[model samples]
Target: MQLIEQNYARMRETATRDLTAAYLDRAMAELRGELTPRKPEEKALTWYDPDQTVGFWARRMSLEAVAHRVDAELAAGEPVMPIPADLAVDGIDEILVTFLAFASRQWPEDFGDGLAGADGRAVSISVGTDRRLVRPAASGVEVSRDDSTAEASISGAPQDVLLWLWGRGDGAGLTFDGDPELVKRLRYLLKEATQ
Candidate 1:
């Protein structure tokens, strides 16, 4: 959080906003230089873990860039740009499986209650041709393709679903059917996972 605090302080400085831009420019260039030569599987340090891999951090940074781009657009009162389906799909998979499903060790305090709220309740998420079911499991919530018993569903374009998961959008563009409480619980869990 130290780096984030420094960045925020720089942005809030009363001297000149151009200084903030210059600092960000230098920081981005430095980050690119550091990461450009790293192999995907190479061990690396990240905010989330002391020793993850280059690929993990790289993927996360790429998604953060997309999310921040949307943030900037919305802040500027500009229409949100289109995200490539492949990137959106990959983002959805990474956030759900990598961060939420398989990584119980990183789960937040409310994970158990959240999982219980979703028990016997599966929400099918359809992104383009990709389909997944989110349901309770031994560890937190598990996302799978077993949609045969799905009692709820959220279907939308790839970008929409990805943005929804990131809390970038209100999901107005997405179609949600079945139990609202299940969806609310899913949103709560998402807030826990992302924030």
Candidate 2:
């Protein structure tokens, strides 16, 4: 758990730092007339205000990058790198617990209730410590957990699973079993993130 947490933290920090530097470079270019700033009325805008802090964006980007890195490593058929269990727990807590909790709360009330009968469905996540429970939302999508005792299991190298959770489709190297519908729904959630 500790190793997962440490790696996650390191990945997050590295991603944030790299992205910040890139943003800074672009902003500097705009200031020097090498690039043009978007008009205030532009319908599409990418850059944030230079004076405004972008911690939220940084965190999101960090997680996305780290998740993909895990995927890439796994796809290469390399040995699964172990992360601190605590860090893995923290990543799950932030992305699944905290972030997804907010998403569930903020989701439009009219949004069609997720998969039918998904509420009582059991899921187990075993990236580090084991977690087991019914799907959090009516939405069918969910993270994978330990299958040794789970009714339906989704197992893979941590990185592949993380990438799949984050919605990366290139998970040919990963393994999954049972509840194909649930897996599809989970994949959909990841796809939504890309949009």
| TM-scores for every predicted model | 0.81, 0.48
lDDT of each: 0.72, 0.46
Please provide, for model 1 over 89-152, each residue's C-alpha lDDT reduced to its tens digit, 9 standing for 90 to 100: 9989877777676554465464656665455578888987799888855457778876476777
- Top TM-score hit: 1
How would you encode candidate 2's per-residue C-alpha lDDT over 40-127 as one tens digit per residue?
3344322333212333333344454456546544565544455434444545544554334344445523234444435535455445
Residue runs of model 1 more than 4 Å from their true location after superposition: 1-16, 46-51, 103-105, 108-113, 137-139
Candidate 1's TM-score:
0.81
Model 1, residue pairs in steric clash = none
